[model samples]
Target: MAVDQGTFRRAVARFATGVCVVTSLEGRADHAMTVNSFTSVSLEPLLVLFCVEKEARFYDAVIDSGVWGVSILNPDQRPAASWLSNRGRPLVGQLDRIPHHRGPETGVALLDGAVATMECRTTAVHEAGDHDIVIGEVVGAAVPASGPADEAGALLWHRGAYSRI
Candidate 1:
């Protein structure tokens, strides 16, 4: 039998995850949303992937722009994560209230205090259940000026809460 959604979610939460904000440009506006389902797929060509809910505004933006930025959050960037994750926040206003910089390669906005950032170009898209898995080729990457090279202290998601390890 299929597990209930809540049970599945809770079970999945047992696996600790790093939190990030995936950013992309939609027309002339910037779009971003908190995401934890990001993974590095390969190193040879430098591939990465993030999953976005089918209905999320960021999903469409990623598809339209064919590029996006991944901002790996630091422990101190919880407010940035909360703002991007909040569903009620207007999409167009997401970036206006935050201090961020546009990536040189993709022009996608990356949160200012992110521990690390990667600009990517979409290489493939696969639909799965209620979300879309977007795979990208990393075009550029760097750590924040104030961020440490060791990421053991990075912000993480576990049991529906944010934490640092």
Candidate 2:
């Protein structure tokens, strides 16, 4: 039997996951999006991966940029996450409203108050149904000086809701 989309979505939502903003810059164009599908792929090669909807505005920017940044949101970054995720919002103006800084290594913008951020160079891309799986090799990472090492204040997503870990 073929599983329906709602059934798959609801089932996957049961797994609580951290929130992150994936960002990229291609020449004068830049884009950011809230994502929860980010993951570590391998440590031996310092690899990571995140999936983006093929139709998302930021999708092509990420592909063309070849490098991207992942900002692991903290509890206080709920607004940033919400704003970036809204498909109706203007992509050009999204970053201007947030407290952010450009990654020194990749030039992709990183959210300022995130618990941690990482710069990754895209190593591979695969089309996965409605989304694109981007595999990257981590090149640099940073944590706030006072950020918690534990997951106490990490921003989490579950059952179509946002929560604190």
Candidate 3:
């Protein structure tokens, strides 16, 4: 039997996932989107991947820029994640309200207070259904100097809502 898209999506939603904001620069403009499909593919060479829908405005910018930043969201960043995920949100000045700093290596905006951040250069792009899987090699990374006791837990997506872990 063939599973329908709704069924597949619902089944996959049962698995909890961490949230992240992927940022890239297209000329002097910045583009960003909330993504839960981010993951690490390999460690030795430090590779990571994230999937972006073909229709997302940030998609073309990211594919063309070849460099991007990943900000692993903490619980306090839920608002930023929600804003970035909205459809038809302005393509320009999207990051203006969000607190961020430029990544040293790629110059992409990395959200402030994120649990961790990574700057990557695109190594490959693969077509998958309506989305493209972008794999990148990490050239730079950052984590706060605070101890574990002061760190905020990660923000997660579960059952269509945000949760903390």
Candidate 4:
């Protein structure tokens, strides 16, 4: 028997996952959304994937742009993560309140203080149930010159709320 959506979601919530902000550009406007579904797909091809609900506004922007940026959030960036995840947020100037710089490869906003950032070009898109899995080829990436410190943990999702570990 197929499990109900609620049961499936609740079960998955028990597994912790890191959070990331995926950004894309539509004309001069920037689009972003907080997602915990980002993952490294392959090392040989330098590929990564992030899942976005088909109806989300950022979905179309990323699909049309064909390029995007991923900012892996640090523990201190929880506020930015929460803000970007909100629905019905203003489309324009959304990144103004958050400190960011445009990625050299994709021109998408990459949040300041991120543990790591990647600029990627869409390699393939596959429809998954209610969401689309966007696989990208990593064109560029950055991390702090000193690298991530051991004590500086990542922002994570657990049991429907943000956590640090």
- Candidates' TM-scores? 0.93, 0.94, 0.96, 0.96
Q: Cα lDDT for residue 20, model 1? A: 95
Instruction: Report the C-alpha lDDT of model 3 over 1-165, residue by residue, as the tens digit.
Output: 999989998999999999999999989999999999999999989999999999888899999999999999999889999999999898878888999999999999999889999999999999999999999999999888896513888999998899998
Q: Number of backbone collisions per candidate, in order?
A: 0, 0, 0, 0
lDDT of 1 by residue, 21-52 (tens): 99998789988899999999999899999999
List model 2 lDDT by residue over 1-165, tens digit each: 999999999999999999999999989777899999999999999999999999888888999889999999988889999999998788666799898888899889998878889999999999999999999999999977754533447999999999997
Instruction: Estimate the TM-score for candidate 3.
Output: 0.96
> Scored by CA lDDT, what does every candidate get?
0.89, 0.91, 0.94, 0.94
lDDT agreement of model 1 with the native: 0.89
Ten contiguous residues minimizing lDDT sum, candidate 1: 144-153
- Residue 149 in model 1: lDDT: 32
Residue pair clashes in candidate 4 = none
Give candidate 2 regions above 4 Å deviation: 147-152
Model 3 per-residue lDDT at 16 = 100
Q: By the TM-score metric, which is better: model 1 or model 4?
A: 4
